[model samples]
Target: MKKFIALVSVFAAVLLVGCAPEVGSDKWCENMKNKEKGDWTANEVRDFAKHCVFK
Candidate 1:
């Protein structure tokens, strides 16, 4: 049971990490561009401008 739990935890972590591009990365910028503007959080909008646009 412990082994199975550990495997599931690891799988969840991997899936979470793989679900989004790293912040400020080119891929992240592209993803933001494609994503719905209405769905973006305030912080995401700020970071997108700070890192993706200004940089």
Candidate 2:
């Protein structure tokens, strides 16, 4: 039972991480272009991608 739970946990984590949006792709590019244009910082772009694009 313990081994089974551990395996399930690992698999779940992998699935979650794998579904995360990757940086510097078409989605990211579109997100950047659509964002308000006015001296946005790198961190802002990253956060936008993580929350808006990824989610």
**Candidate 2 lDDT, 1-55, residue by residue in tens:** 9999999999999999898556566665666677686866988677666766676
Off by over 4 Å in 1: 1-14
TM-score of each: 0.69, 0.44
Candidate 2 residue runs with Cα over 4 Å from true position: 25-55
> How far off is residue 31 in model 2, in Å?
9.5
Alpha-carbon RMSD, each predicted model: 2.8, 8.4
Cα lDDT of model 1 by residue, 1-55, tens digit = 9999999999999999998888999999999999999999999999999999899
For candidate 1, the TM-score is 0.69
- Top-lDDT candidate index: 1
What lDDT is obtained when candidate 2 is compared to the true structure? 0.74
Q: Rate the local accuracy (lDDT) of all candidates.
A: 0.96, 0.74
